[model samples]
Structures are given as structure tokens and as C-alpha cells.
Target: MSSISIAWIALPFFVGFVIYLLPKLDRYLALSTAFASVAFALWLFVVQSPINLQLIDHFGVTLILDPLAGYFILTNALVTAAVIIYCWHSGRTSFFYAQTIILHGSVNAAFSCSDFVSLYVALEVISIASFLLIAYPRTDRSIWVGLRYLFTSNIAMLFYLVGAVLVYQAHHSFSYVGLRGAPPEAIALIFLGLLVKGGIFVSGLWLPMTHSESEAPVSALLSGFVVKAGVFPLVRFALLLEEIDPIVRIFGVGTALLGVSYAVFEKDTKRLLAYSTVAQLGFIIGAPTVAGFYALTHGLVKAALFLTAGILPSRSFKELREKAIATPVWIALVVASLSISGFPLLAGFGAKVSTLENLMPWQVIPMNVAALGTAITYAKFVFLPRGGEAKVGTGFWAAIALLIGGLFIANIAYPEAYTIANIVKLLLTIALGWIAHLLIFQQAFVKLPRLLEGFEHLIGVMSLTLVVLFWMMMA
Candidate 1:
């Protein structure tokens, strides 16, 4: 079982290196490897047990196979496989495939690793691979975006390393289980660092620029899977740092409101989705189990949406409406948009309901408001005019089918989320969102200050966030 778990982490890197050596077979190799990884992860779900392995003196690596990790790994692998299928004919180079596989392996390692050191290593690997992937196309914009990502990521990782050193000093171990009763300062630093990567507001100010500027498939992977690398650790922090729930809740609410507010005003389609990603993280930071569910639903649907956006020929909402006339693609877009908006009977609805089920009454209102904002944001995409046409292919349809199917399966699998009261809440949120959209978002002049769009401003905001987080932890 332990070896199998390790295999899950190792397989992708191995296959990726091999594909690099044989560029002609890159597509076939990547597809087969991705499918095999998904199958193996599923098998691990059945046979794997939580196990801790000692890699060296006073240092050990742990593989946790609990439902949370299992669910994340399974969903991540599935999305990766789907993306590989979509990219098979996209004329990507061998280096792209190699980086994609490395990204997958790094993320898998992060999800399964139980020690802070291992998680940090996994995060570093993911950061490097993501930087390369973002810059893979070698466009001037992509290179700049990737550089911003790299700079912010390095700062985050530095904080993570500092926190890890503090943890080791305090507890003599870097393991999650060993960190009990450790200093709050150390934990705060670590959490704040992870928040940078987690796509929370302030620290995650780099997200929209990077996500919006990257190539379509890279954007899909970034929004869908890579951001969750930071999020998974945050979920663990929420569970482990029980005393800090209030702080987490406060930050979560702030981030949710801030992200949705920006998203509501944004006109670029992918940028809007990127801001929505920030808002959605707010829902997850305060609730652990719900975090997993929300991440799964969001990752799958977001990937499909980005891919669908790629098939269509527009970056602005108005242009997308005027240009996207393919029926099958439009249907896929609707499903993805509705799912993100928490429409009843969809995966997003289940995740949203379940997340709300865990929130406090005060927290509930902000969450609901965020949900409504999400609806308002997506309303642009769903209710827009449709007239232009683009060629749809097998990859697009196959990827869309898998993602939408996952939503239905999630709804069925989590029956508790399907209650009448939750359904009513979802309806109210959607209705309010649509009305708000008409009143506010539909106005031509509504726009946010473009200050947050600048890389230097974002760095300042991230610094301020760290100071604030530290003060909050001390208080």
C-alpha cells in the first residue's frame, strides 16, 4: 500500500521524463499515463491506508489516505486526464507535456504528504512547473505573468520555510501530528504563506493577471488544479488550527466579498473567472470537508469553463455572446456557468449547500452574499446574446461531458446536500443574483479601480496581508 501510494506520486514524473525523450510520442504517452494515474488513484482509494514512513533520522514522510485526500486526488487526476485528452491535438510541444506531468505529480504529492517539509517540497515543485507552464508559449505577456507568479511564489515559499523552521524549533518535528500546541506565530506565518498560494484576497492578487494572460489550456490547469495546491494546505490548517477558526472565518468573509466585488465589475471572461476563484476560496477556508467538496466541484467546472472558453473566440463577455454560436459548445458553457452559480441539481449547488451547512449564522449571510455575487458574475455568460460560430471538436465535447457528469455524480453521492431547505436557499441566491446583475452589472459604466491589476500593487497588498495576519494571530 505504501509503495502504491508512492507510485501515485512518482508515476507522472517518470512518464513525463520519458515523454521528453520521445517527443514524437508525447501525445500518446501523456494520455496513456494520465489515464493510468487516474485508474491507480482510484484503486488506491479502495486499498490504501494512512501510513507514515521514516525517510531519515528525525524526519519522516506520511501518506494520508483519508476521504479528504482521496477525494482531492481522484478529482485532480480525473481533471488532468481530461485536460490531456483536450490537449492531445492542440499542437503543444514536448516540453509542455513534460511540465504538465510534473505539475500533476507535484500536486499529488502535496495532497498526500502529511509533513510540512514534504508539503513545502511539493509546493516548490508545483511552483516551478507552473511557472514554466505559464511561460510555455513564450509570449511577452505570458513571460511577464509567469515572472510575477514566480516572484510572489518565491516570497510565499520563503515564509513557508521560515514557518517550518520555527515549527521544527518548537516541536522538534515537521509532521502535522507533531505540531500540536506549537506557537501560534509559527502557524500564522505558515498559514499566511499558504494563503498567498491559496488564491485568497490580498496575497492572491497575482491570480487574475496570471490566469487571464496564460494560454487557454494552461489557464484551465492553473485555475482548476494548481491553485488548489495552496488550498489543500489551507484546508489542513483549518482542521488543525481549531482555535483560529474565528480568524479564518473573518478572512474568509473578507476574501469572498472582495473577490466577488471585483468579479462583478470585470468584463474579461477569463479574468472574471479568476476573481471568482478568489471568492470561492473564501467558502473553503472556514470549512474543511466543505473545502474539499467545493474545490472538487470548482476545479472540474472551472476547467471545463476555461476549455469551453478556448473553443469560443472571445475574451470579453459581449464578444463571447456575439461570437459563440455553436449549440453544443453553448450548452456546455451553460452547464458550467450554472454549475458555478450553484444552480439546484448541479455539483456547485451540492458543494455550496454543504459548505453553508457548516457555517455560523453570521458567516452564513456573507457566504450567501458571495453565492449571489457568483450568480451575478456568471449571469453575464449565461444570459448573453448568442450569434457567431466556431468549430467544436471531440476533445471539447469529451472534456465537457466528463466534467458535467462529475457534477451529477457528486450531487448523487452527497445526498445530504439535496435537502429542500438548501434547494430553497439556492433558488433565493440565484434569483437575487440575477436581479443584482441587472441593476449593477448590466450598467455600462460600472468598473473597479485597475490598481489591483498591477504587479507591484499586488506585492504591497500581500505584504500588508502578512502584517495583518501576524497581528491578528498575536491578538
Candidate 2:
């Protein structure tokens, strides 16, 4: 990589200095810092090269430049930018902006890392930063949530550490290239570790509590990029384990379906979004078991949508479902809802179609359920009562741009597309989602179905147990 690559490394440092010196310039500081980081990452797309560093003579780390990493970096940059814009007017503490800069920089580092050691260190850096960001406002609920995240995250990292030790003992290297034919036990253990951080079922217990409570911008970053830090690594590990055990495929599907089921009824808008993350991840995690492209699209679109969803004001959720939002927030929520529900011609649709195309019809039950579940949750937003104040801004447009960009990518990759069957299936999903909402979730229903409200989270806990059981059996 050129010197520009270092810009990614330097982002957090630069933001740190600004925060330290001109604390009062908080607004401009966040805007400029977010833009700078995205700009640097965008520049990386043009000046791509491999940057290898000697952490040790025997164990150096390499940063690889490829489409996969670029896609993620780009998504992270766009979402962060949108989030910063969304938060620009919100009365947040300067500390939040400063921490976001730090988190973004660490995420850049993590995405660029090519070795296990670098990846692990980078992951840890983001984890600590994320926990603090959650607790920064220092409310009792936030503090308790952050502590829960801290404890669970440390335990997950410990699992990663143990897995790392075993891998190093067996392969004698921390580089991803070092683990080519490792034992099944090591791969399974490492995945078990990573699943926790990836927000996969079971070990992802802390996600809802913390994610739903954090400040909107922070929540966007956490769901959008932070949690995904574990995904590519999981995909890599899954590839490594393909030969050892095919059953991991089963785990992925089960987890994905379960996540959608619980996400169906999650009450808090942010938490509902958080549960969808698990379901979205579940869809992609099952990708390695089928098609590489499925996983690829899922990661890109999921990250973008998650971040965009988080940046909008809390009113976006409540007003849409409980009462009409201000015109601007309502429009933004509409776009977000469409993007997440995978509406025909949207980014989510492409990801869902691609993943489903990679699976058998019988295997698509969960995929259908997940799509329906997501659609239903978002539809609830559509029902928000008549009116509120309106103010649309750059953040809202940024989300629309991302949704369009994702659609463009999908179209380019799969032209002469949109099978009639696919169209019918999508329409059916939307109809079912709407009908389900009317029957069970409508305000007139006088009571929200707790099962639908908390479905994704319930599935998350269940998936976690299933993973542990699978691990035990394999062990």
C-alpha cells in the first residue's frame, strides 16, 4: 500500500488530536473526521497494494487489497459518513464523536489485517472502544448494558485466544495462510469463539441489550461494522473447515432461520434492527456452505443497511408505528424499511435472491420466513399514525444512495435477471408480512404479540445453545 494506506491508520490519531485540542469544535470535528476517514478509504480503492509489517521476524502480518476487503471498507465508510451526518444535529456529547473516530479507525485496521494476530488485536481494540462508546453517556441502563457487553466480549475473545493458541501450536504461524489443513477441533473452536463476536446466535447475547441502548450513531457503527468484524473471519474459517465437516452448513441455516423468527416480534425499533442483524448474518453465514457470491452480497448490503438504520432518530421508529413521523423522518424510515425488507429491486432483494438461488427449495423455508419476518417488522413502521414534524437531510439521502449502489452492484453481477418465480415469491413475502402485521401487530389488535415482538432475540439465544451443542457433539 502507498502512504495513503497509512491514512487509514492515522485517522483515529488525527481525530484524537482534534478532540483533545478544540473540544468545543465538536460538530465540525466529527463531520471532518468522518469525511476524512471515508475519503482515505476511498483513496485506498484507487491506490491498492499489499502492505506487510514485521510484528515479529517469525510472525509478520500482511494487509491484502482485494475486492472483498474493499467492499467492506467501502460499506463501512459510507455508513459511517451517513451516521455522522445523521448525528450532526442531534445533541450528542463530543466524546461520542471522538470515540466514533477511534472505532472507525480500528475497524479499518481490522478489515485490512491479513493475519490472525493482527485481526485479533484489531478486534480487541474495537471491542474495548465499542464498550466504552456504549457507556459514554453513563446512564444506568447504558452502563449496565455496556458492562454486559464488556464481560461477554472478553469471554468471546478468550475463546478466540484459546483457539489461536491451539492453531499456533498446530500450524506454527498466526497468518491465515498458516492454517491450511488444521484439525477440525481447532476450526470448530475458533468458530465458536468468533461466533460470539460475530453476533451469531447464543454467544451474541449482549447484542440486543447494548445495541438498542447505545446512542443512534454509535449503534449504527456497532451493528454496521463492529459486529461484522467477525464475519469474514468466520467465512474464512468455514472455508478451512469445509473438508473436515459439512455439518457446519446445517448450523448456519438453522441459526439464520431462528434469527428471523425472533426478529419478527422485537419491540424496540433498534433492538428489532439488531435482531435482524443476526438473521442477516445467518443468511450470509450459510453462504460459504453454498455460493461464495451469496456471502459476498450479504456482507456488503447488510453492513450498509444496518448502519443506515441506526443513524435515524428514535422518532423514525416510534412515529412510523405508533404515530406518523415528521415528514422527513417518515420518508427516511420508509426507505430504510424497503431496503431492509429486500423489496423488489432493492439491495436486500438482491442479497436474498442470490442466497436463495444458491440453496435448494426445501432449504429456503428459513429464507422465506426471514424475509417475511423482516418485512413485517418494517411494515409496522408504515402504520405510524398520521403526522409529525419533517426534516430530511444528507444522512437520509446517504442511505438511499447506498441502497441504489447495492442494487447497481447486484444488477451488474446478475443481468437478464428477475425471474417471474422470484417476483411472485417476493410479492408473496411482502403480502404475508403485511397480513401478519395487520392481524397480530396492528394497534387495533390492542396488544402486540410478544412472540413476534421478541422473535429474533429469542432465536439468537436458541441458536447459541444449538451451536454449543453442535460443538459438544463434534468435540
Candidate 3:
């Protein structure tokens, strides 16, 4: 690895600080940062290796640009570019661009780190930047949700830190190899922390409110990249620790079902998409090998969906039905939503089929069920009218066009998805889901339990989940 590769992490941080000093240059700097990231992601694809990043004179950790991390960084780069491009044409402030660029840099850092201590540092940076990005709108609600995100995320990291301490005491290293001889309690704690951060099942109960209340572009970042921070590493570590794989997939299945159920019943447009983010996290988590590909496609589709939401007149379904949307935005929404729902001949179908083909037979059926639920969830928005011109700028279309293009580009992994058998199955899934949507959409909204709704409740759930993870690990 070139020592110059350190520039990958350092350059973004430097640009972010520069953005703070020269706020007037924020948009150009942010776009430049995105373009640079795209260039580096391309480089990592061609040449993969581990770089030892020395922070202090005597201290350093390894950061690898393995294919897994490369895939995620590429996805992160493209979505971040799309978002910055979208904001470039908007009336947004320099502060938003600066923070977003910082957030984008932090995620790239997190994706590249190979050791627990460095990963934790990167994750905390991501959390802080994410908190700032989501709350930038400064509404009372946005502020409240942002603080809630900070508090919960900090607690989760505390578990991760403690677990790292336990592992280091036993093995005296921060590398993933250090976890090789660590106790189950230690592993469980780390798993619990990552589970919450990864947006799995009860642990990720914070997702909907955080994503929905944020501005559209912010929501895109949250769903498309933020939650994947924990998931990418978790999947990597799971591949190392065989005992953790089934456990992660178990929770992954639960997350998919729980998220899609909420999405199917959701009335708010952004919130529904937020729920869909949670569901796709499940998909990515449930299949470790295909996760990079699945996450890439979903990330691209989600950016398109959330950005499309931003161009809309209202978030409420009733209001959206009454309003006429622009042709470009509407087409973007349909294509993105269908791709997300695993429609045949789309990026999502390929990813989904890859996931199913890789899963244990017993696990396949429930994942298919979740896939069906996904179709039903997106059905609510697929036919929204494409009549009015929304006065959006070319940058907006440019961003969406880039993401939609990436969707097809991502299909290189699963050409077998076009097989007649898989196509028929996916078609049937969508047809049934659409029928179910027709039946269910007319009913009043279903309310979920309030007992597990907030930060305090989530803390309790995390404890319970930790206990469960311990039992699973020890068994």
C-alpha cells in the first residue's frame, strides 16, 4: 500500500476544516471532496491492501481496503456525491455542506479501519457528524431527535468500548484478531453495541423518527450510509467469528420483518421510507457474502427515494396524491422503489436473489417473506402522479441520474437473477404484496407498542438483547 493512501482519510478531514474556515467555498470544496472520494474508491478496486496508519509516534493501527470495504466506500462515495450535488443547486447553507462533507469523510474512515480502537474512534466521529447533519434543520423536533440519537449512540458505543477493553485485557491488541480468544461476554457486549448501531430489530428502534424528521437530503444520508457503518464491520467480523453468523442472521430476519411491517402500515412518506431502510439493513445483514452488493444497490435506490421525497409537495400520502409531481422525480421514485422492492429486471432483484441463493435453506423462506413485505410496503408510493413541474434544478436531476445509473452498474454481480424461475418467484411476490396492500391500505393505521419507543426504553431493550446475545454466544 502507498503511504500516500493516508491521504484518503486525511484529505477529507482537512477539507472539512478548510470548509469551516472558508465557508463561502463550501459547495465547491464538498463537491471536490466527493469527486476525490470517487477517484480513490476506483483506485482501491484496482489495488487492495492494508495500510498501517500511524497517529502518534509509537501508536498506529491497520486500515484495509479489502474488496468488502472497497465496495462500501464506493457506495458511500457515490451517495455522498449525489447528495452534495443535490445540495449544490439548492439554497442550503455552507454549514450544511461542511458538516455533510465531514460526515462523509468519517464514514469512509469507519469503513477502512481494521482494529477495534480505531473503528470506535471512527464510529464516534460518524455519530457526531450524523447528529449534526440530522439536526441542522433546527426545528424543535429535529433538535430533540438529534439529541436522542446522540444519547442512544453514545450508550451503545460505551458497550463497545467496554467490550474492547475486555478483549484487550485478554489478548493485548485492538485488531480483530484480538477477539479470537476473547470471552463470550466480551463478544456479546461488542455485538450488542454494533447491533444497535447497525439498525437491527429492537436495537434500531430509533431509526424511523431520526430519518423521518430530518430534511430529505439528510434522510438519504442516514438511510443510505449512516446505519451501514456498524453493519459493514459487523458483517466482516461475523465472517471471522463463525459463532456470530447465525446470531446476526437471526436478528437480521427479525429486523426485516419488523421494519417492513411498520413500513407497510406507515402513512407518512418519509417515515415509510425510513422503515424501508431498516428492512434493507436486515437484508444486508442476513447474508454476509452478498451484503456488499446488496447494500450497494439498496444505498443507491434509497438515495433516489429520499431525494425524490424532497421534491414532493407534502410528506403525507393524502396530500401527495392530491399534488402533481414532476416527471423526472416521479420516474426516479418508481424505479428506485421497484428496485428496492426486488422487482424483476432491476438491481434489487439481483441482490435479493444473490442473498437467497447464499442463505441456508431454512432461512430462505422467511427472507422471501420479508421480500414480499417489502413489495407491499413500496406499493403505496409507486403510482404517485408525475404531472407537475416541481421547479427543481438540474443539479437535483444530475444527482438522481447518477444514483439511478449506479443501480444498473451494480447489477454486474448477479446476472443469474434473470433466470425464469427467479423472475417468476419475484413477480408472484410483488403481485401478492400488491393485493395485500390493496386490502391493508384502506384500514386505519396500526399502532405499535409504546413501551419500547424512546431512549430509556431502548436502553432496556439493549440490555435484554445483550443478555440474549450472551446466551447465544455461550451456547
Clash totals in order: 0, 15, 0
Q: Against the true structure, what is every candidate's RMSD?
A: 1.8, 4.7, 2.0
Native-to-model Cα distance after best TM-score fit, residue 348 in candidate 2, in Å = 1.9
Winner on TM-score between 2 and 3 is 3
Q: Order the candidates by TM-score, highest first — what do you get?
A: 1, 3, 2
Model 2 C-alpha lDDT per residue in residues 1-475, reported as the tens digit of each score? 4455665567665876688677788657766766675566556556566345544455676666545566566666666665666666667777777777777777777777777778888888888888888887889978877776776667667766776777788778877766566555555556665777777765565676567777666776777778778776766555655543244455567667766766665556667777777777777666654333444344444544454445444524444454445665555556557656766665556666776776645557766676788788778666655466645566556654654465455545554347888878877888888888888865332323434224355345534654664465356
List residue ranges in candidate 1 displaced over 4 A: 44-54, 321-324
Ranked by lDDT, top first: 3, 1, 2
Candidate closest to the true structure, highest lDDT: 3
Candidate 3 minimal-lDDT segment of 10 residues = 50-59
Superior candidate under lDDT, 2 versus 3: 3
Per-model CA lDDT versus the true structure: 0.80, 0.64, 0.84
At residue 214, candidate 2 shows an lDDT of 79
Looking at model 1, which ten-residue stretch has the lowest summed lDDT?
Answer: 48-57
Determine the C-alpha RMSD for candidate 3 after optimal superposition of all C-alphas.
2.0
lDDT of 3 at 20: 86
Cα deviation at 405, candidate 2, in Å, is 7.3
